[model samples]
Target: MSEPGKYVLAKPIGEAEIGRLDLQHRMWLTQHHGLYSAPISKSSKQRVVDIGCGTGIWAIAFATEHPDSHVLGLDITLPQPNSAPANCSFAVADAEGDWSFATEPFDLIYGRMLINSIRNWPRYLKRCLQHLKPGGWLELSDVAHRFFAEDGCSEAESPMLRWWRVVFQESSRNNGIDIDDTYKHAQQMRDAGFADVRERVFKWPVGSARASTQEEKVIGDLQYQNLQVLIGGVTETAVQHGDLPGMTAQQAQILADEAKRDVVENSDRHGYYMHFATYVGQAPR
Candidate 1:
C-alpha cells in the first residue's frame, strides 16, 4: 500500500490489471510507437529502468525480448505478477524521492503519461538524469492536449468542449499539474544537460472517418472510457473552487452521453484527436 498523502497507491501492476486497464494499455501501445519499437537500441548487457511503470507490462516485455539485459520497474504501485522474468523486477519507489535503490546508473530510463502527476518538470528531469549512466537514453512521452476535436467539428460554443475544458482545467489545478503544457519536455532535457534530443508526435484520430478500422474504433472507445474517470473529479473540483456552477449529477451524465455520441459517430462533421508527444535525449558520456 502507498503511504498516506501519496497521490497514488503503491500496489503492483497485477493489482490494477482489470479489463478496462488492459484496454488502456493496448491503446497506449498503439498510440505510442516508441513504447515497443525498433527505434530503441538495445545492448544485451544494458540495464533499463521504467519509471512509474504501471503493471510492469513494458518492463516485462523488454525483459522478455532482451534476455541478457536487466529491467527494473519502479512505481508507487506494484502489481502482483503471476510471473516475472528473471531479468525483470518490480519495486516500490516514489518518483519524488531520492531513488536510493538505483545505486548504479541505468543505461535507459523511460517515463510515460506522468505529466499530470508531477508538479515540477525540471526537478523530475534532474532526477532522471541522476539515475542515468553516461550516454544513457532518457525518453519521456505524454499527451500534449486534452479532448482533441477536428477543426470546427466541435466549436468553442460546443457544450462538450466547454465541459471538457472546465473539467480538465479545474482537476489539473487541484492536482498541481499543468495540463496545457508538458509538450516542451525536449527543452527540459536540454536544460538537464542531456544531448541529442529529438521529439516525435503521434496523432490518435478519435471519432473520425479518417480511422479506417475497428482498431481505431477501439482506441476511440478507450479514450472516452478514460475520460469518464477524469470528468467527475474535475467537475467536482471546479464546483468546489467556485469556478463552475454546481451541476446536478444528471447534468454530468447528460454531458458524458453527448460526448460519447460525439466520439462514436465517426463524426466527419468533426473529429477528435489525441496528441501524443515523446522526447528522447542522451546523457553525455
Candidate 2:
C-alpha cells in the first residue's frame, strides 16, 4: 500500500530549486552541530550512515567534506551522480528491513524528511541506535505539514491548506503510516536511549522577507514555489483517484491556482512560514 521510495513527483522549479536540494542537505548537517563539532576529527574514527539517503546528495557532500570518514547512503534506489567521492558510496536497502551490511557501529546516523515512509517510529529509532556506536550521534529532521503565518502577516484560510492536509492524512493512512509529529522527535530520541538531546526549529517564510529577518528571502520564495508544486501534484493525483474525499475537481483547481498565485505574486501582507524541525542526540556510552 505504501510507495516507500517516492518522495516527490513534482516538476523542477529551476536550477536554483535543483541547487537547494544540496543547500537543504547542508543546512541539515550544519544544524546538527554536535555531530560536526570536532573540526579536525578523523574520518576513520567516524562512519556515517544516511538512512533513506535519496539521491545521496548529503552523503556525497559529507564524504567530500570529511574525506577521512566513510559514508554509506542507503535507500531503496541507488540513482545518483556517478562522480561521487571514493569515500562515499550507496547501497539499495530498506529501512524497515534487516541491514546486515552494517554490522559495525557507525559514528553518525542521519535521516531527514522520510516521515511518510516510516510506519513505526519506535522500531526505526531502535534500529538507528543499534547501528550507532556508543557515544555516536543521531541527527534527524522533518517538516511540519502546516504552513503558518508569522505574526503581523495574516492570510485568509486558503483551500490549499485544507486540500494538502486531506491528501497527506489520506495518503499516510493508505500507506500504513500515521502522519508524524516531527516536533516531538526529541522524545523519540530519548525513548531510544539517546542522551544530550537537542531540538531546533527553523521557519521559512513564503516570499520576500519584507518581514522575517532570519532567513534568506529569495531562497525561501523559490522553496515555497517548489513546495506548492510538490504538495499540489500529490494532492491532485490523490484526489482524482478518490484517495481523498470532499475535494471536487473545481476545488482542486482553485486550490492549485491559488498556490501558483501565492508564489507568483509573492504577496507580502499574507505571510506564511514553512516549519522545519531537527532533533539531535548522542547514544549512551
Candidate 3:
C-alpha cells in the first residue's frame, strides 16, 4: 500500500505518468465529444469544478474553450503546470473531504476516470449535487475496466486479459472500491436527487487491426500506447496488492508484457476493447 496522503494507485506521480494521463485526456476528447457533454458552454459566466482532476488537462482545456467560465481543478496532489489560463486554477483537495473550498455553487462539476480511486459513489454524487447550483450539471466519464471481444474473438482465452480481470477485481475489493461503478452512474445520480440524467457509451479499440478508418486507426494507435503505460503503472500495485494468486511483481510484469504483445501482434485473434460511459445530470431548479 502507498503512504498516507498519496494516491492509492501503485504508480508514482512523475513526468512519465503525467504524460500518459495527458494522452488519456486526448483520447477521451477524441472518443467523447470534446472536453464535456453537459450544456455548460451554452451559458456564460459559468463556474466549473473538476473533481479528481489529474494533471489539470481537462480543466485547462475547458477554461481555454470557455474563457468566460472560471474553472477550478481540484486534486489530492497537484501536478498541474505552473502557468495556467487566467480563468483556470488548480487546488490541492480531496473529493471525498469536506468541500469547503467551493464557496459558491458551480454551474458544472466534472469528473473522469475516477473509478479506481473513489470509494463511495453515492456519497460522491450527493456531494456533487450539493455543490452544484440549481440547473447546473454534473458530468462523469469512466471506463468499465472489463475487456470485451466482438467478431468471434474470445478475450477469455488470453492469459493477459484473464490476469488483468482477476487482479484488478481483487484489488478493488481489497480497497473497498467498486470496479464496475461505470454501470451504476445513472442510478447513483438519480438517487442523489439529480434530474435530466443522460448517459452515453463508447467503445475504445485497443489496436489498429480492427480500425477501418483513418481516425479510428489513430485512436487505436493511441489506445495501444495508453495500454502500454497502464501495464507499467499497474503491475507493481497489482503484485503488491496480492490480488493475483502466487504472483510476484516480476511475474505480473511478464503477464503484462504478454498481454501487451497480444494487443499489438495478435489483435486479430484477441480483438480487445473497453467500454467507456459518460453520464450527465442536472440539479433541479
Name the top lDDT candidate.
3
Highest TM-score: give the candidate number: 3
lDDT of 3 at 90: 87
Write candidate 1's Cα lDDT for 148-245 as tens digits: 66666544445566666655555566567777655678777889888877776666665436676665666766665665555555565555665544
TM-score of 1: 0.79
Clash count of each predicted structure:
11, 2, 0
Q: Which ranges in model 1 have alpha carbons more than 4 Å from their true place?
A: 1-21, 32-41, 153-157, 212-254
lDDT of 2 at 243: 69
lDDT of 2: 0.66
Ranking by lDDT: 3, 1, 2
For model 1, how big is the CA root-mean-square deviation? 7.9
TM-score of 3: 0.86
What are the per-residue Cα lDDT tens digits for candidate 2 across 111-210?
8887776778888888888888888878777776666655443335544455446565665577676555676677887887888777667665566655
Task: Please list the C-alpha lDDT of all candidates, in the order they appear.
Answer: 0.67, 0.66, 0.75
* Local accuracy of candidate 3 as per-residue lDDT tens digits, 141-187: 88886777665554466755765675656666777877778888898
Which one wins by TM-score: 2 or 3? 3
Q: 174, model 3: CA deviation in Å? A: 2.1
